[model samples]
Target: MRLYSEQRFGLVRACVARDGQPLLYAEGYALDPSLTLWGTRSVARLSAKSGRIGFLKLADGQEAMTDLSDPDAINEGAALEIEIAAEARADKLPRARLIGMADGPLRRLSGPLPLIERLKSQARRLIDPQAVFEAAEDPDALDIAEAQAIHPSFDLPGGGYLSIEPTRALIACDIDMGGAGEGMIHTPRQAAKRLNEVAVAEVARRVRLSNLAGLVVVDLIGNKHNGEKLTGLVRDAFLAESPAIACGPITRFGILEFSRPWGARPHGEDTPLKAARRLLWRAVAEARSDAGGRLKLRAPGPVADLVRQCLKDSLDPLTPRLSVETASVTEVVPVR
Candidate 1:
């Protein structure tokens, strides 16, 4: 797999690709050596306990949870060492595992590892993003624009499309044959089976790409029998992408159910911090190109405050020209 990292919108964006196709994308503040949940060792105080689960609060006030072997072994407010296993995704809290009791001072052993280092561990070849962008017919614009897409659809290789609906409870996937079966000279049943197979493979890729977890229901374009026969294919397809998946048999209603583990943050979650970063990134780019006196970032109150708080960390030689102003909408423009 090839990996590329570039600074955009005040954050380091990384993309993992295989055979010239993007597999995964991630973004973060690379220079900040402060507290972060992903890939860090820190000390936390046990805030609460319930059976085998122990809730903890780090020195930076980030909440995490770990499995305790014995409920009564450690009391609340006790200090413990932890290694963060995964980041906070969707509504789920960050996950960590106990590394034994902490020593004298309750402190963080290390901050979050750099995002580029993390990507390098998994990638086979590291190439400059500009090279990839220049060579591709349509360079991948990895940005927050995806968060604006609520109900996204992807066209399948054949004549069909897959519509994905992500709700608070679960994700719903619908397979529309469209014109995929038009030229097929097989029986209706056979044609549906063929389309289902291709659709399931694509579903597996999308699930991983979006970091979709919890319960997922896929509505295949086939009958109950066709759904049942395609169960193994579904299982294998998901297994190739995510190994720890629990797949249920095809239901009588022609639906395939399965669950995958949550890892990274959901691909398209729009938040104030992301908006703030985007505005700053644009402001910085504008300051670099245009001979402007003041680059004012106008955003919503919350986003503007976020930009002000992070202004120091993101500023480079353009520090003197940077400013933040509250506005109903978010934008970065020059001010005389």
Candidate 2:
């Protein structure tokens, strides 16, 4: 496996590619990575309690939710060091597990480890993603991989396409033949089987790529009466990666269901602040590469304000050479 790091503009973006396929992508501030918060132990106060569900406030003022192993053992306002299991979502708090009570002051004891240390186990070769981005042609390899994680539709190997939509409840995958069998009306079953084969393989790769967890339902292209064959194909595809925690047979509606253990937050689920930071980084790169003495970056009003407010320090070095303005769309261009 190869890990690519693009360290620029006070941000570090990394992608892990195995066997020519990009599986995971993560980014964070230069010093502290948001990914490190998961799986790290920290001190937090039990702000509020409701039975086994407890609300925890970290020293940094962040809140998380975790089940109290012994609800009776701890009371509200007490301190406990908890291990974060997963990062937070837009509507949900981070998931944590109690690691026992703490005696010291409420603060981060250790954590936010170096990005390389956290991800080095999965990769052997360290690469530079920016090199790939600069050398690649239109639809760069890294860009295509990143787009697949965010975009809902991706084409199959030979033909057809699959739409993978992840909702709060489960991930739903829909497959379409889409002219894969245009002139083969005589062999509909044979054509459908081939399409389904391609769809299942792509579906499995996407599940790993997007870090999708929980229940996943796939609606295959053709409706045949072979449940075992469909599930077996999925199982074989996921055998290399972590096999599903549980795999269910295909349903009558041509749907297959399976569940995988939660790993990290799904890609493209960034908060507004994180998105703004990324945009600012892109703008900075544009300015650095331009030959003009001055450059103007037009971005959404809120995004412009974010950089001007919270990220002013990041731009101080390039002031006079770069300026930001509010526009409906975000882009950077050299000043005349």
Candidate 3:
């Protein structure tokens, strides 16, 4: 058995080398004056086999052992050199500067086990040491399912609908109070307040869920004199819910402007507009091929008129099988 003990007197920088080649170096810091690694500490781990670098949390007194001989492929002969440096701290923990080296001939102690079992065993020991030993002798009494469902969703009262319309450049939500407001206090102001509160919460959630980026405008029901109050409420609600999100100030026009990080919109499974455009193009192509002539499409309504005007201005008439579609209130599935 090889015993490996490492204690930091002050700030320590540890370098890990494999096969006489420098693999990685890590620096540990004491955030508090007491020299305790309670808060976040920087840790860097680099791959010897691959040149990839990884950063992680370095908690004090955390030890891990692995065998190099097994299929796990841990190279135990890998040398580790630790360099200690002294720092002035008000707490006066200790001051020592020394270099340390360690080597181990790793050996496997047990076969591979399921992650759940390993975690359960580790947690049991940490939480209740006496119970862990007793429970080890009698394993049949433990209810695994109780531990599995640790965090479950609490059901919401309202059946809310969230509509993300990119064309409109706005997210409109229609929420039905849904039986929860049956016997409670009911007034336009009160109702608006409650709905606004719920909507604000939902907005933050949807922003995260949808990962929507760019200028977002929310068209919420206007509250009379409480407009400014409502805006403040929504702004405060979002700030509390998601501190990381950079939301801008709400304008007097009830437009809330903010930007999410750039990427593909989440849950962006084929929109109806895209589907309609695809179908329209396919149909126009088929029509042109059948007639062996150029196809002309007329503007149908206000939305279609806008699309036609746009097409005429933006596209060339000589372009083959040109297709166009417009936005509408009705939901239609385009057929090929």
Candidate 4:
């Protein structure tokens, strides 16, 4: 989340250690006026080889390299340490004094130390609020355009519309026993148990697909039955979805809160199927309007090819004025 400068571009860098070694580094860039920032586009460029130091070009074309070979060159190697003389002036660039040598090979020349210092000095000013806002808003248009294609007027069970919000905390689901029946033979307790079981399964699936994490609250249908039965059902459901997720005991109000560890946060809200359909439709429309009026799409490989074949088989019979094309976006992976 911190921002720094790198050359003329703004750089956001974070220090990370791997295998007890302070080697991993995260670097991001602020978008220039012409470019739009959308979602978490920050790429974590890690060193592929051990003891190897190199620079990576961020999205904004800002360069960052580690000086692992020499400690003296602050801007030349992966190491950031440097020495200064007592008489050194504040305005002038300090002379590079060799403090120590690193135990690795030097890959490339780091940027100038004065420029690096200036970037570090103006780090606060570079962290622009406007830039974050611009980036966050860029993805909405695409999501909306995609959603419209999938469901022109899709409606949720409740009156709420589909929305994407940015938050550090994970999303939780609560199911209340609405105006359902409470019978003497079946008992309200039995109904509550069934509803709780269904809610647990559905919530788990949503968490996985949405990449939700942290605390999750699930308010089940309140019943006069034993709380132990409800707690056991929730526990079993959690285990079935993911054993790693830890859950607290059911609360007196019949609320179950749990946590799911997510490797990375989601950038957008469209499901895989919905995203693919939107992209495909947009490309078709574009291709139709082009000079040649022919459409060609780059898909992920076999899947793309299959989609293209399906499109051809379905649309070829129409014999329309424009030609539609299809291809694979990527290679197929074994279904989990």
Candidate 5:
């Protein structure tokens, strides 16, 4: 876990890579001990909507004064990590490291899961664990690191794929069963079931990784049995990650509906300009950290152009110490 410089790294994710393939990941939240539930008011002043998520306790006849300066301790994010790590480790063979984050208020992770663990309870093998605590080491990690602003599409293990979209009405995931399960099963019905099985598992994984919540509509291509099987599979899939998930019977259109808690914002709200600024800082930091290497930043056109100037204006002092480049693209990468 790490403490984020909200100004620089907007939505940071802890990514574990098995070789070059992007594996499991979790988003990072700021860990400032000084930070509190109330930003500008005391508990007594907190409105019903603005009130925090804890209870106050006192002894009989004891009257306590509201101390706006000191609020309750907050480490649930860290605690969750610790619990997840433990659960992930029961199978053994994976190692975890709290790298880059120093012992201070900036630490963001808390958990027992090590460097690697089985991707899930049903996976046959454990993954080689490695977290992106600092900066992304490759283009894939950088690209898939954060999901809030990421494209909704995700590739499955076989040939099928998913396109996730957060629509105004609900979160929609359309599964296009490609050749992935074609040759694996002989009959069309069998192939549909095969793809349905694979799609359900992957959809569950994607939902958790992307932290996509609320009314979710999944469109799968298959028959009634295939849809029914998929509905059960999805329920079982989210049983651990989100037990509160409510899945119902599939419709004639092969749509499965379910809802999960909107625990937190999947991605922090960062304007493109802010993202551009952070990219510039990343480039400079990378360059400085590496005395002679050049760090190239690939981002959308507007962001690249904006950061190019940021490098020109604010980063002048570090010019001699750093070598950086920014390339423009059509899509924006939240962070690298």
Candidate 6:
């Protein structure tokens, strides 16, 4: 397994690729990582959402998560040692989350453990440190733009294209064979089937790439007779990528709904998830390359907060080489 990490524009973005396939995309929100568990011990704020118990950490909105469906609720702002849990494929609170409390004590979780730690634990295997990329110098390393474009809708490989829209209700995906483009067929059914085939793979990747969880409605073009036959194809496609997703029966209308948590919007304004990862990496590299005991990071509050929180693990090997310093610290060294 190889890891590619980058930091730029105050946000950090990281991707994990194995066997030449990108399996994971992790971003930072400083407060709202699509899935971020900050410090093992955090103050919890309780609430109710969709009849389920919701927990929020006032200090970091990114850590806002829900508790299991139980009558017991923790007092708001009560500090507790939180345990991390991961849901393999379902989207309603799918992905890694705080399942309960850890047995040990802590000084506020030492600030969210490095994402690499979580990534490593999930894989149950060590990452290739030699291949651990900080940027483009590594041959297999994909630039952040290419990494960000891993979404099928944005990275359509042929004449066929897809339009994905996320709403409060569900995510809607529409496939357009883009008619005159490459790999398109003359027969309408064949073209629709071919397009749907391509869409199956693309949709599967998109769902995982976007961290799209919750209810997802995919609209493919095909004859009603083909819907049943194609259902297995669609289901298989998603299963290859994530078992957490389950597709509902297809309607004559050619609509299929998938259940997963709603991920970050694909086409809207890009959130800071990627940028957070980038800054985190850049700071680490700069820290390791620096001569002083202090590594200076100069990002705004959110960006700096993410770097300070997520780079904990990577900082260890280089600790004696360099230490962490916020932009505000100006006596010894300064970085912008």
- The per-model lDDT (C-alpha) reads 0.69, 0.70, 0.33, 0.37, 0.46, 0.51
Preferred candidate (lDDT higher): 1 or 2:
2
* TM-scores vs. true structure, each candidate: 0.79, 0.82, 0.28, 0.36, 0.50, 0.58
Give a tens-digit lDDT track for model 4, residues 1-336.
222122111322222211222211222222222111111122322222234443333333433333335323333323322222111121222122223434333222233233223223222222222222111222333334323322322222322122222244545465655543335345767656666665565554344333345567666666453556655655554553356567777777766767654322232333333233444445444544553444444555443544454455443422232232334342222111
Q: lDDT value for candidate 2?
A: 0.70
Which ten residues in a row are the worst by lDDT in model 2? 130-139
- What is candidate 5's lDDT per residue for 1-336, written digit by digit as tens? 211112223323345443443434443322212111111111111111112332211112111122122223332222111101111111221112111112222222322222112122112122212323333345335445454234547676667787887765688888887776666655777766776777677666666555456798888776566555677788776655445778888887778888875432343334465466556556655655566654566776677666555556542544444333455552322233
* Cα RMSDs, all models: 4.9, 4.8, 24.6, 19.6, 12.7, 8.4
Listed per model in order, the count of residue pairs whose N, CA or C atoms clash below 3 Å is 0, 0, 0, 17, 17, 28
lDDT comparison, 3 vs 6, better candidate: 6
Best by lDDT: 2
What is the model-wide C-alpha lDDT for candidate 3?
A: 0.33
Tens digit of per-residue lDDT, candidate 3, span 228-260 = 554565555344324434566555665555543
Which candidate leads in TM-score?
Answer: 2
Which ranking of candidates, highest lDDT first?
2, 1, 6, 5, 4, 3
Winner of 5 and 6 under TM-score: 6
lDDT (10s digit) by residue, model 2, range 94-166: 8887888887777776667665555553232122223223111222545656666666468777778899988
Residue by residue across 38-91, what tens digits does model 6's lDDT show? 223343444333345555543345444555455355444444444334332223
Candidate 3, residue 45: CA error in Å?
30
Error of 1 at 237 (Å): 4.8
Off by over 4 Å in 4: 1-168, 182-186, 223-243, 267-279, 282-336
Which ranges of candidate 5 are over 4 A from the true structure?
A: 1-13, 16-143, 147-149, 181-186, 226-228, 241-243, 268-278, 281-336
Model 6 residue runs over 4 Å out of place are 6-12, 18-21, 27-112, 121-141, 144-152, 180-186, 237-243, 262-336
Model 1 bad stretches (over 4 Å) = 8-10, 32-36, 120-152, 185-187, 224-243, 281-294, 314-322
lDDT at 179, model 6? 54
lDDT of 1 at 162: 87
Model 3 is weakest, by summed lDDT over 10 consecutive residues, at 144-153
Task: Give me the displacement of residue 325 in model 6, in angstroms.
Answer: 17
CA shift at 21, candidate 6, in angstroms? 4.4
How many clashes show up in model 6?
A: 28
